[model samples]
Target chain A: MTYCVGIRLNAGLVFLSDSRTNAGMDHISTYRKMIIYEKTDDRFMVLLSAGNLSISQSVRELLQVEKIDGHEEEGKSGEPITIWNATSMFDAARVLGATVRRVFEQDGRALKQAGIDFNASFIFGGQIKGEAMRMFLVYSAGNFIEATGETCYYQVGESKYGKPILDRVITPATPLNQAAKCALVSMDSTLKSNLSVGLPLDLLVYREGEFSSNDIVCIDDKNPYFKMIHETWGQRLHEVFQGIDDPRWDGGDSAHPMMVRSARYDTMRKITHPGERIV
Target chain B: MTYCVGIRLNAGLVFLSDSRTNAGMDHISTYRKMIIYEKTDDRFMVLLSAGNLSISQSVRELLQVEKIDGHEEEGKSGEPITIWNATSMFDAARVLGATVRRVFEQDGRALKQAGIDFNASFIFGGQIKGEAMRMFLVYSAGNFIEATGETCYYQVGESKYGKPILDRVITPATPLNQAAKCALVSMDSTLKSNLSVGLPLDLLVYREGEFSSNDIVCIDDKNPYFKMIHETWGQRLHEVFQGIDDPRWDGGDSAHPMMVRSARYDTMRKITHPGERIV
Candidate 1:
């Protein structure tokens, strides 16, 4: 189990991932799930992965050399269609998808024989020189879907516990650092709720139009900013929860009364023995 | 899909369940998943179900007359032991479990043949005369686990999205009203994140030593207290999220700096084409 999230905001793109993997409760290990591929002044792409670690590792190793046939014959001159030479981000993602399919062709059959699912997914997103910043969620079948303006972020693995915050805060117009903050808050919730998602996070903030980024940080338990976030968010949430008024059931003169005569009460299937009226 | 939670607190107990059921995206309907049984001054129990609606409905219908063999000969004098006549909540829960097993014996084989799992669960908790408040999570196979002080609540169906808040808040010492509010907040999070869980909740609050309760509310979309919670919690949560400072990455003289040199940074597995230094 892992938790990884990638966001495409108007200002930039944000990528974060956890590093814990477990085969059983006893056999737990840490493996980096994020890989940063940068060709200076030309392209910057980050691949965040979840699912079977072996399959993802194979995909990543093959991705550097895997090539897809060029969509147009114009760019077909003696050069292999790889991420470094791709003209657009979409083509790079195609190369990534092909790499995943290659891994499936290599291992999918033997994996099925062992009754293990061929489950792996990737959050591949970044920018090339000529194209706008884009993001995609690559599936286990090597197919992919890009994030749109209406849905600007994609999260893979253990997504539900952290989703309410992302749904509430993220937008296309959210600033880069704020989106990063929201991602961290979401990660914090995931960490608190799930044992499989641990700390020592890899956070990358890529500003739009910059082919290379310097906003990469490796956050262990000692990172000051993440420490503040982990402490402040939980404390503040508890404070906010305490500030809310409790429901009063006495039919007292309160601003928000708990017991009101609802029309649906009579139709409810509440059971009681004879000579007892509970509603 | 459904969301139901039962909490055991020192002051009393709180039970809440949503009324949405879905077989597929096109086959969505409303069905109440909670049932209250009261025998004045003797017992007060609420059964909250989630999973295959048919199986649970069958279980609920059968629970009324389902009887188990008495455990002790002193109380086994030609009497059929049922929830209505059980002396302890434990025996009542056993009767409920037997009822579930009976349902499985009736329909489990056909359901399995049709490739549908015999999935069902219930959060059954209440106090019987001379017994303390007890809560049990009855599984499809009729095995059950009781909620102790260490884990004071049980939630079935779509439980993860709403679990972080409850993990942070609930305790055996929490008051009844506050616990009820926490349950509603948890349900709100579930409703916000999942389309399968909808409104029209049934909430019951019972005090210690009271075998019958009138503090039951049928809360639809228009209920004032729920409406206030839906409004205030979202708004205040947004405010709290905004109040937290965004990470500053430029090595600025801030209290929390984003990019700090870490020991693990040197060992990170960042991939890049040659001649580019990203860290």
Candidate 2:
């Protein structure tokens, strides 16, 4: 299992992925699941993948050389229609979809024969010279969906544990570093709750119109910022939890009381005697 | 989808379930997924269920009269070994498991033929005379696993969204109301993240020694306490998030910084020209 998230905002795109992969409890391994496709002034893109290793590797390998119909016509043979020359992020994603389908065509049947799902999901997002930054969640079927104003981010695999913070913090106008902080906090929550998602984490922060820069880092247990986040967030969260007054059964002095009278219904019905049913 | 959680603590047990069910997005209904069976001085049990509605309903129905093989020998003819008369919580859970299998025997084949799983999961917990309080997660196969000191809670369906907070807060020594508050907070997180899990909610709080009490409540949209929790938790969480200073990139006066210089690798790689890939 893996947890990968990509956010595309007006400011730019942010990408993060955990490196833990496990065949079982005893077979855990660390594998990088993020790839960068950059052509600075021309285009900059990132790919974050989750699911079976073989499938993702195939997709990555094929993506470098794979082509969509138009891309193949544009690029010379052997040069390959790579992420480099794509006119738009949409076309780049299509190249990605084609790469995924190529892997599926090659291994989907054999995997199905072994009762394994051809499950692979990708968060592909970036900026091209002519268009705004965009983000997409590519599915196993080679189909894809883009994020919009209402939903400005895409997360694939082990997404739930990290979602609440994202839901609370992200916006199209959020600054790049704030979004990065939110992503790390989200990753921290996921790490606390789930074993399959671990560190060192791959984090990339992109600023709009810059194509790309040196904002990526691998966060291990020893990284000071991550270490501070891991400790501060947990301690502060517990403080907040404790700060919230516990429920007061007697409607005590606290401004926020737990036991409040209601007009809607009585307490739950219970069967207190043998053969009794309170309906 | 539904969300139900059961926690066994040193002080007592806590059970919480949502009341939303949907056949499709177009057809939604509210159905309570909790039931209580008690015989005052003898026993006190609560059942929280999730999964296929028909199967769960059938299991619930069967539980009224379902008896296990060994327990039947102790009953008289035509007098069902009901939950009320079950001598121990384990036996009561076995009866619940048998009830589930009986439902499977009746509809499992037809459901399988229709490509729908005969899925139903339950969290059954309570205290029976002469035994300590216990909690069990009963599965479709009629096999069950108990919650011991190490793991004090069980959740079924739409559980992941709300799991992090519970993981952080729950312990054997947590007070009953606080645990109940944690369960509600958990449910709130699930409700916010998942459309399939909605209100009203069914909450049951149990005490260790008391056989029964009037602490259970059906919390609908209009319930004041729930309304407060929904509003306060979201607001307070946002406050906490804001209070935590945003990431500082240059290690200014802020106590926590975002970027930590490392010797291992350069920041994320970028390509400056078309056809360039970061290797």
Candidate 3:
């Protein structure tokens, strides 16, 4: 299991991934799940993967050389269209999908015969020189969906445990560093609640139009900023929880009371005797 | 989908459940997921359920008359045992499990034939005449596990989004009222993140020694206390988020800096050209 998040904000893009993988609880190991593809002044892309480790590793190995057909114009028929040569992020993602399919073609039947699914998914996002930063959630079936302004982020593997904070905080308008902070906090929640997602995080912040990024770091337990986030977020959450007034059962002079019953439904169904019917 | 939570503390027990059910995104409807059974002055119990609504509803209906065998003393051979007659909460839970098995025997084959799972789960907890407060998480196979002091709560359906708050706030030592507040807060997070879980909540708070509880309420959108929670929690959560310092990318004079990188791993794998191999 793993937890990885990719966010595309108005300011730029944020990519974060945990470095834990497990075959079972007893077989836990650390495996990095993020990869960067950069051509300095030309393009910058990042890929975060989760699911069967073997299949993902295969896809990553194949992705660099994977090519999509028909990109060649008249005289350019021999030129292979790869992630580095694609004109758009969409094209790069298609090549990634093709790479996934190639892995499936090679391993899917064997895995199925052994009673395992060819499970793998990826968050592929970045700029390809001419377009704005784009992000995608690619599925195992060689299909994908793009993230839009209305939902400016994509997450894969063990996503739900850390989702609420992202829902409350992220939007297209979020700033680069703020969104990065939010992603770390979200990862903190996942780390606290799930043993499958551990520390030593890989975080990369890409500023739009840079076509490359220098803000990349691998955070471990000793990292002060992540430590601060882990401690402060929990403490402040407790404070906020305590700050909210508790429900008043008596409906006293309080402006808000818990005694208010719903107008649409009857009181909760109570069965007092063995002969009673619920409806 | 549904979201329901039950918690047992030293002070008492708390149960909260949302009322929404949906077959698909377009077919959403409201159906209460909680039921109470009280034999005033003798016992009080609550049941919160999640999964296939039809199966749960059938189990609830059958549970009224559902009975276990052999509660009879030597001479009372003909006497049957039911939840109403069970002296301890454990015995009552056995009856509940038997009830679930009965439903499974009746409907499992038909549902399987239609390619639908016989999925349903329950959080059952309460105080019986001779027992301390107890709680159990009952699974679809009619097997159950009790909640201990270390892990004093159980949730069923759409559970992960609401779990972090419970992980942060709940324990055996928490007071009944405070646990109830925590349950509502947990439900609030679930509602905010999931559309399949909606308004009109059923909340029940029972004190340790009491056989029945008057602190039962059906809260809807108009409920002020819940409204306060909805507004205040989100606002305070944002404030708490902002209150934490954003990561200092420059490794400046700040006590915490985001630039600290892991010592164990190399910098992220970067593909510089189309011919690059990840391995």
Candidate 4:
């Protein structure tokens, strides 16, 4: 299993991915799942993938040469559309979708015969020279959906354990570095709860309009910043929990009392005999 | 979809369940998913169910009168074992499992023909006289596994979003009130991230050595203590996040910096042309 998250904010974009892959409990290995595509001053893109490693690796290898016909008139010198020359992020994502479909056509039949589902998903986001930053969640079927201002992020694989933090903290106006910190915090929660997602994280911070970014790092257990985050966040969360008053069940004259019964639903039913029914 | 959690600490047991049920996005309704059984001074048990509501409701209705043959014989009248007369919690759980199997025998074929899986799970926990507290996770096939000291809790249905908090905060030594607070916090996380699990929650707390518990409450949106929890937890979490320093990208003289690159892997590969390959 893998856990990867990408955020597109007004200030920039943030990307993070864990490096563990497992076929079963005993067959665990480290596999990096992030790739960067940058043509300086032209476009910059990042792909974070999760699901079957074989399928994603195949899609990544095929993506460079994958092509969709240009919409130009016949007999004209229109180059075949590719990620490198695609004018908009939307078109680049379509190229990615086509690449995924190509791989599915190659491997989907054999995998289905083996009773394996065609499971793969990707978080693709980047900036082209003339366009604003865009993010997409591309599915195994070669279909995709873009992020909007109202929903500014996408996460794939082992997502639920780390979701509440992202739902609470991220917004369109968050700064790039701050969003990066939040992503790490979210990842910390996931790492603590789930063994399938392990360390040696890949993190990238892309500033808006830069077209290319150098803010990339690999974080293992030795990374001092992430170590501080792991320790401090857990300690501080426990402190916060301790500070809150426990529920008052005695109906005391407290600001919040838990003893009050709901008016809408009756108190829970307790059966005392063999023939008792709840209603 | 539903979310229900049951935790057994050395001090006692805690159970919490959400009350929303949905056939589809358009067909949403409220149905409570918890039931209690208590023969005061004899035994006390709580059942939390998740899956097909019809199946669970059927199992609950059938469980009261469901009987297992007793081993006693030799012309003596041995009353068929029922939950009310079961000598141990394990025997009670078997009866519950047999009830589930009976329901499946009646409806499993029709449900499978309609393309719906006969999915159901339950978290059943309590104490009967002469036995220590026991908790079992009962499945659709009438097989069950008991929770131990190492894994002192069980969750049924839509459980992942709420798991991190419980993992962080719960242990065998945790006090009853604190564990109750932890369960509520877990439920809050699930409710915030998932629309299918909603309020009017049923929460029950049972103390060790007590055959019955009156600490049952139905909590709705208007419950003041839960309202305080919802507000204070979000606010404190935000405050904790703000208190942490953002990552330093410029290699400043800070203890933690985000600019260091990985020594193990090269920077991600870039494809500049249509025929470019990663290798």
The per-model DockQ list reads 0.66, 0.49, 0.63, 0.59
Model 3 ranges off by over 4 Å:
A72-78, A261-265, A274-279, B71-78, B261-265, B274-279
Q: Which ten residues in a row have the lowest lDDT in candidate 1 chain A?
A: A70-79
Write model 2 residue lDDT over B15-104, tens digit each, in one string: 999988888998889888998877766788898889999999888776877766453444544344567677778878888988898898
Off by over 4 Å in 1: A72-79, A261-264, A274-279, B72-78, B261-265, B274-279
Clashing pairs for predicted structure model 4, backbone only: none
Score residue A169 of candidate 1 by CA lDDT: 90
Give the CAPRI class of candidate 3. medium
Regions of candidate 4 where Cα sits further than 4 Å from its true position: A73-77, A261-265, A274-279, B72-79, B261-279
lDDT of 1 by residue, B1-279 (tens): 999999999889999999999999999999999898889889999999999999999999999889998766755555778989998888899999999999999999999999999999999999998999999999999989999999999999999889989988999999898999999999999999899999889998999999977778888888888999999999998999899989988748988887764443475676778666646
Every model's TM-score: 0.96, 0.93, 0.96, 0.95
Which candidate model has the greater lDDT, 1 or 2? 1
Per-residue lDDT of A74-155 in model 4, one digit per residue for the tens? 7775677888889999999999999999999999999999999999999999999999999999999999999999999999
lDDT of 4 at A6: 99
Candidate 2: where are CA atoms >4 Å away? A71-81, A250-279, B71-81, B251-257, B262-279
- What CAPRI grade goes to candidate 1? medium
